[model samples]
Target: MRSDRRTQLLRRGRNVECASLVYNIIEVAVSLTAGFATGSSALISWGVDSIVEGNSAAFMVWRLHGEAAGISEREVLKRKKTALGVLSAAFSIAVVFILYEAISKFISGETASLSWWGIGILLVSLVVNPLLAWGKYRYGKLTDSPTLKYDAIDTIICEYQTIVVLVGIAFVQWKGWWWADPVAALLIVPYVAWEAFHAGRDAYQVDLDASVSG
Candidate 1:
C-alpha cells in the first residue's frame, strides 16, 4: 500500500477509537445508573462491559498513534501484544463480575424493575455500535491492524449484549419472568470468554514471534 494511504487509514482508525472511547464513557455512566436503580443484572453487566470497552479504545488510540508516528514493525508488534494482554485481562475480569452479579441475583430471587431510560440507551447503542464496528473493521482491514480488528469484534460483542439485555428486560416487564435478567447476563459470558481466550493466546503468540525474530 502507498505510504499516504496507510497514514490516512491509521488516522481514521485513531479517530474511530477516540469516538468509541467517548461513547463508552457516556454509556458507562448512564447504564450503571439505570442498572443500579432498576436492579437489572444484565444492564449492570453492560455497564461493566462498557468500562472494559473504554479501556480497550484507549489502548487502541495509543497503539494507532504510535504506528502513525512511524514506529518500527517490532515496536508496533510489541504495542499490539501489550494492548491485547490488557484487553484479555479486562475481558476476563468482566466475565467474573458478570457471573457473580448474575448468580447472586438468581440465588436471591431478585427481579429488576422496568426502566425506560435503560431501554432508550440500549436502543441508541443498537444503532451506534454497529456503525462504530463497521468503521473499525473497514479501517482495520485496510491497514492490516489486528488490534483494530479485535476492537471491532469487541464492539460487535457489545451489540450482541445489548440485544440480549433488551430481550431480558422485555421478558421481565411483559411476561413477569424475573429470572430473565440474570439469565440474559449469563448468556453473554461464553462469548466474552471465547474472545478473552483468543486475545490472550494472540498476545502470547505475538511475544513468541518477536522473540524468535529478535
Candidate 2:
C-alpha cells in the first residue's frame, strides 16, 4: 500500500475505535437492565461478556494510537490469547455461579418474570454486533490489521452467543422452561474455556521485546 493509503486506513481504524466504544457502552447498559428484569443468568452473563468486550475495545484503541505504530503478527496473537484466557476463566466462574443458582431455582421451582426487556436488548445486540463487525472487518481489510480482524471475529462470536441465548430466552417464554435460560448460559462454558486456553497458549509463546516497557 502507498503511504497515503496507509495513513487513510489508519484514520479509518481510529474512527472505528470510537464506534466500537459506543457499541460497547450501549450493550453493557442494555444487557444489565435486561438481565435484572428477567432474572435470567444468561442475560446477565451476556452483560458480563459485554463489559469485557468493552475493555478489549478500549485496550485496542490505546494500542492503535498514531504513535503506537504496528506490531508483529506474533505479538497480536499473543495478546489475543491472553484476552481469551483471562475472559474464559472469568466467564467460567460466573457460569458456575449461575449453574448453582439454576439448581436452587429448580429445586425451589421458582418462576421468572417474562421480560421483553431481555429480548429487546438481544435484538439490539443482533443489530449492533453485526454492524460493528462489518465496520471492524472493513477497516481490518483496508489496514491489514490483525487486531481489527480479530475484533470482527469476536463480534461475530458474541452475536452467535446472543442468538443461542435468545433461543433459550424465547423457549422460556414460549414453553415456561426457566431451566432452559440458565442452561443456555452455561452452554457458553465450553466455548469460553476453549478460547481461553488458546489465548493463554498464544500469550505464553511470545517473546516480548526485552528493551520495551510493558
Candidate 3:
C-alpha cells in the first residue's frame, strides 16, 4: 500500500510538472512576440525567465519519472545534482540577458509602446502561476522531494515577475513613465540571481553528501 501511494504521488508530481512545462512554453512564445511588438524590455526578460523555469520543470519531470522507475539511490542522487546544476546555470544566463536588455534600454532611452496583449497575458499568469506553485508545494512536501520544493519556489518567483512587469506596463500606459519597463526588468535580476545562488549551493551540498556517503 505504501509503495502504491508513493507511485501515485510521483504520477501526480509528473502531471504538475508537465503542466508547468506546457504553460511556460506558451508563455515564452506569447511574451516574446508581445515584447518585440511593443518594445517592452520587461516582457522580453519575462520570456527569458519562462525559458529557465521551463527547463526546471523538465528536470523535475525527469527526476520524478526516474524515481517511479526504481532507479538506484546513487543514480537518483546524481540526477538530482545534475538537475540543480542545470537549473542554476539556466537562471544565471537569464540574469545576464535580462540585465543586458534592461540596461541597454535605459542607455538608449528606448520607450516601450503600450501593449494590451502583454497586460492581458500577465493578468492571466497572476491567476495561473499561483495555482501551479501550490500544487508543486503540496506534492513536494508529501513526497519529500527537494527538487519539487525548489521548483515551487521558482514558480512563485515567476509570479512576482508577473506582478512587477504588469505594474511597469501599467505605468507606461498611464503615467508615461518609460523607465518603468526597464526598471521592472532590472528588479527581476535580484530574484533570479538569488535562486541561482540557492540552486548552486544546494547542488554543491548534494555533492558533499554523496562523497561522505560513498
lDDT by residue for model 3 over 58-140, one digit each (tens)? 98899888877777677778888898899899999999999999999999988999777777788899999999999999898
TM-scores for all candidates: the values are 0.93, 0.79, 0.94
Q: Can you write out model 1's per-residue Cα lDDT over 1-214, one digit (the tens) per residue?
A: 2398888889999999999999999999999999999999999999988998999899889988887877777777888789889989998999999999999998999889988888999999999999999999999999877668878988998899999999999999999999999999999899878878988998888853452121
Error of 2 at 189 (Å): 1.8
Which digits, one per residue and each the tens of the lDDT, describe model 2 over residues 1-214? 2366666776677678678887778877887787777677777777777776776677566555532355654454445555545655654555566566556666776556666777887888888888888988888887777767877787899898899889988888889887887777777666655555654564565455432122
Residue 107, model 1, lDDT: 96
Instruction: Find the candidate with the highest lDDT and give its number.
Output: 1
RMSD to truth, every model:
2.5, 4.2, 2.4
Q: Considering lDDT, which of the candidate structures 1 and 2 is the better prediction for this target?
A: 1
Best-fitting candidate, scored by TM-score:
3
